[model samples]
Target: MIENRKYIVILAFLLIGMVYAAKLFMLQVVDDTYKRRADNNAVKRVMEYPYRGVIYDRNGAKLVYNEPVYDIMVTPREVHLDDTLAFCRLMHLTKEEVITKLAEAKDYSYRKPSAFLKQVSGADFARIQDQLIEFPGFEVVPRTVRGYPHKSFANALGYIGEISPSQLEKMGKDQYSAGDYIGISGLEYQYERFLRGKRGVKYIMVDRHGINKGAFKDGKYDTTAVKGENLVCTIDLNLQQYGERLMNGKIGSIVAIEPATGEILSLVSGPSYDPNILRGREFGKNFSVLQKDSLVPLFNRGIQAMYPPGSTFKLIEALIALQEGVIHPETHIACNRAIINCHGPHSFPDLRSAITNSCNPYFVNTFKRIINQEVNPNTFIDSRIGLTKWREYQLRFGLGRQLGLDIPNEKGGFIPSPEYYDRYYGEGHWKHSTIYSLGIGQGEILVTPLQMANLAATIANRGYYVTPHLIKSIGESGQPLLEYQQKNFVGVEARHFETVVEGMADVVDHGTGQYRAKIPGLQVCGKTGTVQNPHGEDHSGFIAFAPKDNPKIAVAVYVENAGQGARAAASIASLVIEKYMLGEIKRKNIEDYALKGKFVY
Candidate 1:
């Protein structure tokens, strides 16, 4: 009986042992899923970034571009530098400099590739090419840095640079890394999602010499890098360049548009910088220089700046008055500056003349008539409730708010309603006398140079606009945006705009805009404004379109601290027109005088 029990126990023990052995064999020999996961840590697959999109100006002029640069990448953990002296000599740095750079690189991160030398010039790269064979892990990778064929659209084209860790934290870990370049301003910021192409991943294997082997697994797992889609802008390079030249050494902005289509022809913000300075090996140094320039070159004064629309708002008021039936085109108002204590003493024959002279009291009277609903005009918003109706009309013209333009950091110009005054004075406390400055675009009403330019474009189009885009198309052939499809606006009729146009023409003929605006062959209709501000002298403001009949171009120019519109603004805008239409400068003396001209505050 004892022998039988022992035999049974031995058999049981052998069966249990075989079961564990079988399980061990299956896990060790058959299942490799966990082992493969562990192996992944050893082979690091780095992503190779793609080239960014190219930017082109109107007529196929290249604005922003990409130039080849060499980035000296070093994996601190993997790098084996033999002779520090030799390596430093090749890289055009002292031995101690290499050690310092390597220390900094190590401080940043050792597990990943840390760029010790960024944006090495082609000349420097060539000098170090032969010496690179001595370094075990240091390698030269071809990369793209932003380039500019022209000086810049600066505040317009913007710039791109290495992404910071903060940006990575904000963006999360989808595609971008610590060293990726990204669009930082202007159109680039607005359209980054579309402009930045999809990034691809590739599995590369390296040999003993650190030379790249063919793509891992015959490129079956390799993703091809797609070049960014190019953009074609409505900006006419010639016109834009001309406008910049006109405003060179001046402080302000100019925006020009195709009247009928609202396609931007030239958009310039003064104190511009050359985009090339922010690229290449000396980018960091050059950028610092621009940053310290007394004249702000980084500000896009066109879209981002807001100033009192000045006399230009007179045209809008006239049209609004006409549409509301508060004033007829022939409504005569006597302007008596000495007697009635108004801006003018000469009696205007009609509303057309009133607008031409930009008579303050005439429009002030018209505005009061509209606000009180003195005439039986169609009611969209109730004016009897307060000056609410008139305020609504002004707001609809894209004043008092950011037009939601495609550019970055656009300003929302303020519009003060009756309620605004009510906050300070009771609703009935305010009168036409208090807000008369609003009639001539001088009061609290504000608009950006971009918005003012659009005002001209909207009038020329008779209603609809294409959202005032710098880029006309995207990708190949430049596709147009769908939301901006040509569509008419509500509010004012085409007939309402004609009298304002006539008044504007007459202003060029005999009013404050007479000098420097007359073109020998072209009919330029415009309005001039001299703003009253406590801080500084009046700013020069002018909005105009040429060839009165078939308006080809509409423009707005503003020169900050310049007292009169005709002083510099009109001449600069006219010069830009001449450059675009004539294809050559016909008025050199005029341009020279204008360029060298200065206005004291």
Candidate 2:
């Protein structure tokens, strides 16, 4: 019995040893979780940030590029500083700032790395990089910062900054981290994903002193960042620079578009700051100064400012009237100053002459006929019906609503509807005569400079226009946006545009706009407008498209507090068109006059 008991006890002990041995073998050879955990103590994972895409003008001029910058990163658990005060002084940081940063880093992760000091210039980084080894947890990480070679187009090119908490939440933590840079506005904001590229990760083995030995596992678990795709914009750098020069000391805007393609050539909002001011460490300070300046340089006036279209809108009315058959090319309207005072005296004139002379009474009378025609016989119903139809035609022209411009925060200028009038003046209280000012492009009809430029483009195209856009092509594939390629047709028939075009041509040939807008060989079609402003002097406005047949450029210029379009806006438009077409301005005298001209309220 004793022998049997001894054998039983020995077998039980053997079974226990086998179980313990098998468990040890499984943990050491079969499962990788513990092995990875062990590797984490000796390995560090670092992110590789790719270079942001380059931005170029239509002519392939580099507008924005990236410059190498270094950021000091830290891992809290690995930190072993020889002297905290010396380290703070080396990085140009206060001891309190260093402590605060360290605490924040600990809160993020003890083992993971985080940015400690960002955007250190090359000179500063060079001075301190040799000493970084003294601080075990800290290392210099290479990154890129946006750089502008020309420093112009601040409002159009935008700037980049560290990602905000809100942006991180929206972008997803997996895609972005706290230290990532993001585009804040303009084309940068519009194409961020394509410009930012893809980030990558690399794991490297580190010794007990937190010094990188080499890539972990011979770079088996490493990735290389993909460089961002390049962008080609539609802007003409030369024309844009010239327009900016002409608009110096001005408070308005200029927008030029390629009529056939709807591609914006130059969009200048005056009183702009150099893009360089919004880059580097001084951005916040410079931005605050610009924000407080009286000129409001940050405001994008081309697509955001609302102004009455003034007499420039008369071209549309003439076309709408012609399309409705309420008027003909030969039909004459006697200019009666008693009804609506004419800017100057003129006799009975046909459609073309009326437009050339800018006869206010003729347009008022023409508007009256369209509204009071015996369609409904009931005055209120007929007026409403007519106004509704007019609004429809106006909307088709890409007015009264956002044109879906690629830029952000475009305002839809107001075009009063029947309901809008009805709310203000009761159901049957209003008539065509009540709103006669609208016929001459006043009384609640408003448009941005961009829209006005588009109107000129639509006229240049004779009936259709594509939505104006800034991007010409994206990526190496040079793919143009499909939406901008599609045409948007106005309600007016193509045939009706001929009379209006002839009238515009006549205006430049011998009418109010003649003195300032005529080019020697270019047949420029243009109209002048002196918009009434209660707060100050009239705002000068002009719209033109040059070389009447197969037009190349359509432009709109607005000059605030300028007395007449002929004085400022017309001359600027003419110079811009001439410069673009002829490549050199033969009219140096005119250019000098425009550059030095002054206007008083």
Candidate 3:
């Protein structure tokens, strides 16, 4: 029995030894999990960032391109530096900054690579490339920063910056890291997905001191980074630069659109900085200066700043009245100053003449009839019902709501609803008498310059408009977005726009806007508004479209504290039309006046 027990113990011991040997073989050779872990110790995974897409103007002119930059990446665990002070001097960084950055990298991950210094210019990086070898764990990686050759379209193009921790959390660690640059606003933010190309990775072989030897395994596990898709913008580069020059000293915006296509020709928000200022190492300092400026150059007034539409809104009133059969082309209303203040030189103006003359009482009465059509017996209820219907028409014109411009931070200008009035007054407590100022484009009706330009485009298209867009095409396909191709009809008949168009033409020919808005050889149609301002001088505003037969450009210009619309805004719009239509400005005197921002008739 003792001999049998000894043999059983020996057999059991042999079986255990065989199991142990098999497990070791599986871990070391068959299953690559442990082998990969060991390989990670000597291999460094470097991220290869793809270049962001280039931006071109409608005429195929390069607007924005990429400039090569370098980022110094560090692996905390692999760092072997004896003279930290020498390293700081070579990198143009303070010793304290180096210590802080190294500590931050260590806290993030001792073994992982993090950006130690970013956005070093190609010229600067060239000077330090050879010296970088002295610092063991630090290596240079190629990256790109946006380069604006034109240095225009600061607000529309936007700027890029390091992604915030909050953004990183939502984007997920697999897609973005802490130091990744991202589009912050404007078209850059709107088209980031198409602009930010796929990132590739390369497994690099490293020595004991973390100095890169070469590609691991002859670059077998490497990926090639794909470049981002290019963008073809609808902006006319010449027109944009010209508009920027015209609006140099002004504190307003000019938005011009091609009426037929709704393509934004030029969008200028004044007090804008050069797009270059927001790039490179000085970005942080320059951005802080812009933010603190009192004029608020960073605020995109073209689509974000809302202002009272002023008298330019009268065209919509006439259309809505004509649509509802509340007024006809010859319908006459006396210029009754008792009803509302009157300024234009006309009396007992008909519907067409009222628009040409901008007679306040005529529009006030016209809006009254449109709103209080006796839809309800009670005046309060009738006003609410009328406002609801009026607001619907206004909304169809792309007012009181966001136009879905392909840029971030677009504010929808207010078109007061019955509910809005209810909050201000009380439900059913207001009537056309209380809200009559809205009839003249005042009181709570506000619009962005983009909306006003779109409004002009809508009228030029005979009551329909394409949604304005900055991008004409994306990638090599050269196709605009589907939304921009479709027409958004403003619930008004095409015929109603004929009389309004004729009146606008007449206004440019012999009315308030005649002096500044009349462009020779071009049938420029326009309306002028001297918006009342309690704070200071009235805002000057004008909306126009040229060549009454086949209109090309529709523009809206608003110059704050610039008195009458016929002064600065009208002059600017007419100059823009002449420049676009004639390809030159013969009226250099008017251009000079606008450039100087002198609000004189």
Please state every model's RMSD to the true fold in angstroms.
5.1, 3.7, 3.9
Best by lDDT: 3
Clash count for candidate 2 is: 0
lDDT of 3 by residue, 174-228 (tens): 8777778889988888999888888999999876545677898999999988888
Error of 1 at 481 (Å): 1.8
Where does candidate 2 have its weakest 10-residue lDDT segment?
592-601
lDDT of 2 by residue, 261-319 (tens): 99999999987888888877787899999999998999989888899988888898898
lDDT score for candidate 1 against the true structure: 0.77
Error of 2 at 347 (Å): 1.8
Higher-lDDT candidate of 1 and 3 = 3
Steric collisions counted per model: 1, 0, 0
- Greater lDDT among 2 and 3 belongs to 3
Once all C-alphas are superposed, what RMSD does model 3 give against the true structure? 3.9
CA-lDDT, candidates in order: 0.77, 0.89, 0.90
